[model samples]
Target chain A: MAEKSSELKLLSAWFSPMALRAKIALNIKGLEYENVEEDFNSKSHLLLRSNPVHKKVPVLIHGEKSICESSIIVQYIDEVWSNNNAPSILPQHAYDSAIARFWVSYIDEKLFVCAKNIQDAGKSDEEKKPHSEQLEEEMLVRLEEAFNKCSDKKPFFGGNNIGLIDIALGSFLPVLGLIEEINGRMVLVEDKFPGLINWAVNFAANPAVAGTFPEIDKLILFGKTLLKKMGYCL
Target chain B: MAEKSSELKLLSAWFSPMALRAKIALNIKGLEYENVEEDFNSKSHLLLRSNPVHKKVPVLIHGEKSICESSIIVQYIDEVWSNNNAPSILPQHAYDSAIARFWVSYIDEKLFVCAKNIQDAGKSDEEKKPHSEQLEEEMLVRLEEAFNKCSDKKPFFGGNNIGLIDIALGSFLPVLGLIEEINGRMVLVEDKFPGLINWAVNFAANPAVAGTFPEIDKLILFGKTLLKKMGYCL
Candidate 1:
């Protein structure tokens, strides 16, 4: 099918997991879009006008319309590009779709909150390591169960394809890598969360997202800068 | 289309606006469900098991499947009951549906946060009256614009039918009423937010959610009790 004439533009920021979700979705759907990177400190007028409510990055502009919030943007991409030959990001079945949405919410609300807590703990990596790992372990165990339930032994949450949950969680791979590096240990233990560990590896290796992540070094630098900005020493 | 043989069960609490959303959606779709009211102090095992993550109410059980989260449950109800001869809760078009979802999110995250802050302010009604009114007024102006954009002069966000955004914001009418009553005078001033004031009236009067609200006196009592429990003087 020929791509629609209306050009798609993404107002995004580097090192943003939310923006990465939109990038991966467009890649998976085989859609072409202009990725206009936005500076976090001095945001462009387009970003402000496009997402006036949140005024956040990762606003997907399609022709005259702009969709904000990463998960919503991903869904918009999937729905608007339904005629494309690429696999749909959301599950086709209603029940499965609900389950996918449920876990995606979990990742955004629960999982990422834990990540932020760890990063903002303000203690030396050694001081916060045990508590941080424990906090994440609880969430990881639940996510492992979720991975088993949602993936059903398949390689991806969408069974054979990269789906919403995959994109939502996988977008955090680089940031999680930065956290792991800063903490000097792995939070995603292979023994405790085998399914998720495998899923993470597969997700990063997926063609749709293989090249989507920022370099780990860049992520680490960005994390430090952010934490410093937030008045956290570490 | 025949109704599914499996019965629908909703684990909900009487005083919860979140639970009210599920009720309104089921009502709009003309779906009959057994609403098992849960005690706030001692939640049911079914609710805990169905929604272990949040351990909250408004879990919709259909045969073996249980859907947690109010918005997810509403969407599930819409999809599962697609064959029913009732108006759809979500819009038909993709972009319109996304906009509806965005506003629903705004109501939940932004509008409701303002409501909770007013209720938990701990000041005497007279002391907090102006501040509470101002806090709610700011959100109301944005909601007024959203109403105009989404409803486009129609009676409801769903264009004369009760839709997702309507259920999302409408469920809080009684609570808003409670907040208004406690503050002495109205938060939703008729002059400032004519559309929303009229909408609040129409939404409460709708057959779907007409009799769903708890009595205002009972709501005030509940509000005071909750505030006291949270160590707020008011």
Candidate 2:
């Protein structure tokens, strides 16, 4: 992917999965951007001005324009930077693109919500595990089926290379790891999700995704602090 | 939009806003399709098989393929049948498309959710209305702003044609009307949302969107039955 002339800036928080999706897509596209970090307690004026609706981070300022919402941002990246040399994040075919969009949405509305609920469960770990496990069983099993259906024996969700689904789910790895660490139980089990376990390994090792995840130890520490603030007795 | 060869079938509930979005897009595209009504009390096997992920209606079965989720289904219809003659629902430019998608998302998550909370609030009208009004002040006001920005002085959110945002927000008109009728209050106020008021009138009168809305009396009856089931007093 060749860089374009427009000055790209990402308003991001270091630990935010939403922001991470933007970062990974930018990296994959070979697009150079300024990372303008936001402090949540007091968000930056630019962020407030740029995203008046949600007033949230992961707002991508592309020259004069700003795009918000993580998945939409990723799609914008794929669309704008699509060139013959650049890898397509979304599939080129319309049906395939629809399927990819569906899964990406599932990641946003389902998988990520489950992970957040586990993180903020506030109950004793013993009291929380069953509910979390049930959520996982209902959600992740479908995801595994999605992987098989979408990947079509290829290595990545984008088939052969990283695509939209990869960026969507892969961004949550560090956070998922933190949840597992805190709960002292595996959220992504080897026995239950062998395909996903294998996919996760492949995803982390990919060059484009390698540095996109936050450092696990730091993430866990941050996670515990946030959980404590939310009334969890971690 | 010219008719395509693939046989299109829609599994739908009569009053679902989600199903209505798909129907509007299909109408705008001038694509003819079979409408299979579902008794949600016992959803059909085809629906169960077609959309195992959400297992909800508004699944578009094209020839041998089935696409679920209304927004995605709309997007798919736009992409697959995109011709020089067909009006593009999503904007052509990447930035414009992103902006459209963002507002469509707001319509789904914010506007529709607020409307639902107002409908499903089991408390007395006085008890429920203040909270609902506050939600409206926060949400519909932004939607009014969105209509102004996205529509850009045009008659519809799609600008010169009924685009994705128009379809997204327009689908809820009949349901919003139902809410207004049942509560004996105006959810979409003329003074507050003058632009949207005019836009809704334009949208309803458009030949493509005309007759797409379920009959108001039928919708009101169905809505009351649903609200009673949800423990709301008419």
TM-score of 1: 0.93
Q: What is the DockQ of each candidate?
A: 0.71, 0.89
The DockQ for candidate 2, computed on C-alphas, is: 0.89
RMSD of each: 2.9, 2.5
Q: Write the per-residue lDDT of candidate 1 for residues A44-73, one digit (tens) a residue.
A: 999999999889888999888989888888
List the pairs of residues colliding in candidate 1.
Answer: none
Off by over 4 Å in 2: A1-6, A124-127, A230-234, B1-6, B121-127, B230-234
Error of 1 at B226 (Å): 4.4
Worst 10 residues of 2 chain B by lDDT: B225-234
